[model samples]
Target: METTKRGKVPLYLWMLLGFAAGLGGGLYVNLTGQVVIPEVMEIIRSVGQIFLRLLFMLVLPLLFSALAVGVAEMGDLKSLGRVGYKTLLFTVMVSAIAVGIGLGMVNVFRPGDGVDPLLAQQLLAQGAEGASAIVGSAPQSIEAGQFFLDMIPSNVVTAASENQILPVMVFALIFGIGMVMAKSRATDQLQETLQGVFEVMMKLINLVIKLAPIAIAALMFNLAAVFGWDLLVRLGAYALVAVGAMAIHMFIVYPLLVWIFGGMNPLKFAAGVKEPFVVAFSTASSNATLPIAIKAAEENLKLPKRISRFVLTVGATANQNGTALFEGVTVLFLAQFFGIELSVGQQLIVMLVCILGGIGTAGVPAGSLPVIALILVMVGVPAEGIGLILGVDRFLDMCRTTLNVTGDLVAATVVSRGETDAVVPVDEPLPAVAPPD
Candidate 1:
């Protein structure tokens, strides 16, 4: 529940300081060809690993509690009624498109490729020792039949033990659906318990994130020291691709959905949702921006309150097209960076997980990091490569958060289409209610 700002010094200012120090130090070593002290570099690497291990330690519990609670909270689809189904359908379809756009952009541009060959080899060599176990255990090639079959998991505990993330996720989802069906006092308690677990995990993750400034310094220094200016170029390319993919989804995809499905003019929709867009970008937290989005839907867009509330509220958490797209792009970019080749089936697996991840990922700053890290490990990419992106993530976070909020409003507007309820009148005075004695 803590804002990104903590105490007198904001978390972002600290993060920026860490980024600057690391970048400066790394560039010095790179340009001068002076070797960093071995002991100091080792300490830096250890610090980075500590951070990653902390995240790795909590990944399963976090994933389970978040995904399960998220699904259960949706309530029974039958109970959710017509609007629920429509919102769910729109969320899935639109999130898929967003991921598709990101994957396509990465594959076509291959930004992860075109790095200096020697630099790529050095990165591979550095990561190979730590990554060997994961890389070795990964399937030599993904087969369509086996891939689908393995999703069920012969034993959920065993799947979690082996880091078979997809199977674990499947189990969590089924578990959630089971809670939804039971619908008793015990089930309600179970839901609350899971919700409690999720809140705790979010707190723990945020605490870990507090160390991110140090972690970012270590991570950026490592990359910059070795890769030199090429690191910046590749990082720039990645940020560009991420922003571009999001832009496509926001400007092109959302508008098309609003026009075709919602029967609203695209230009009008864009103008009406501008306030929410700015709020989302500035805050980079969907949950924080929810009130603004609701207001925009009701006031500027003149959407029905009932539909807008339901869709926008759920969309704030469940309908994160932007997060899903970013996850896909980061995974592929890292895979490419590490010289790992994921086949078509594997990429499809990434896309599927991303769609699920979008639903489960916390609506907070840097929330997508845990999911992206796990996906990289799931597919044999080195997890440490996440460091390369963290320094630049705030900007990307802002960009995608805007997309997330905009997507929510668009869903609200689209879902409101043809509802018999009258739109809220702009500038209408509130009806006075008598105070209770």
Candidate 2:
């Protein structure tokens, strides 16, 4: 019931309170060995589910509208080409580096060796039925050429309905390109409408974000009430390794990029990004935090509106450095847990899959789980091993999402720096205004 000057609790405080209460409640339940009624737990979980669903509902519309407008706003073919190439190249290279770091950390730490086999087996058994259902529906194998082909949806409506993000992205990109090429009055009008829709979607996101504190509290409480401390103890090393890799990427890698490529002070870059980072960490959704990230880049970071719009919007959908890193660490941890000794080639394939999966991953909570499960199966590791990390994933999701948004902002800054036309002068006025208008 604590309220800030605005008469509502600040979001960060709300999330912190939720997390603390959940942790306390969970520990109490575990120590006392009291059974929470299943029905009551279900109600709590339902609140969290509703929150997740609300966020998911916005993903497609937000992606399409933002991407389309961002792309169309690029104006001409040549400018679009230059910006697109730099943005994507930077995104892919950074994401690949993140995966490399994850692979290296997991290999060195070998968190799987610390996990008790009996505990792993028990965890596997407990979630076997759900895991089986996941594997039963998973693709038998992923083909390289087919992956590209599948991205071109036969029916975009079907893709949106089923939440096939990659295909939807492909559709948006093509639609945006067409709009740019047409260069007609109607096309301009449509682009304006899409931009308006993008703004509306952001407003809706702000509305839904108000529910986050209670929803996150319910989620954490449910997780604690159901799983307890034993699982955390067992997977502590694996969790540490995953989190540590993300930390390295965030604290070390990103700053280095800002200082080196962006020619900006790393400390200043970090300071500028604080607002978006908090929203991203608390919500665990890059798409949900897109509007704030854009605002930060333009206002605090002084990135050009053109570059920030294109890079950050596309990055929200495709450049998932943190998710890529987590998937790499996760796949390796599960492989080690099951005594699956992957060859060098297999490890490289795992790296590739994770990088690609990160690009396609939706910017929502636990969005990487299904992709992780699929990679596990492709590597002949038990898809059921997903059960091992599910308990700790929500917390890790928060960490990785922070990295994801940070990486996007870094890409925007670095890429903007490279474009002479796109770099706003450091001494430029914050809100440029005509003096005599």
Using TM-score, give the best candidate's number.
Answer: 1
* Candidate 1 weakest lDDT stretch, 10 residues: 132-141
User: Any runs in candidate 2 off by more than 4 Å, and if so which?
Assistant: 1-79, 115-230, 420-437
Q: Which pairs clash (backbone N, Cα, C closer than 3 Å) in model 2?
A: none
Tens digits of lDDT, candidate 1, 239-289: 999999999998899889999999999999889888888878887889989
| lDDT of each residue in 374-425, candidate 2, tens digit only | 5675566655455456556668878988998999999999988855454446
Model 1 residue pairs with clashes: none
lDDT of each: 0.82, 0.72
Number of the top candidate by lDDT? 1
TM-score of each: 0.91, 0.60
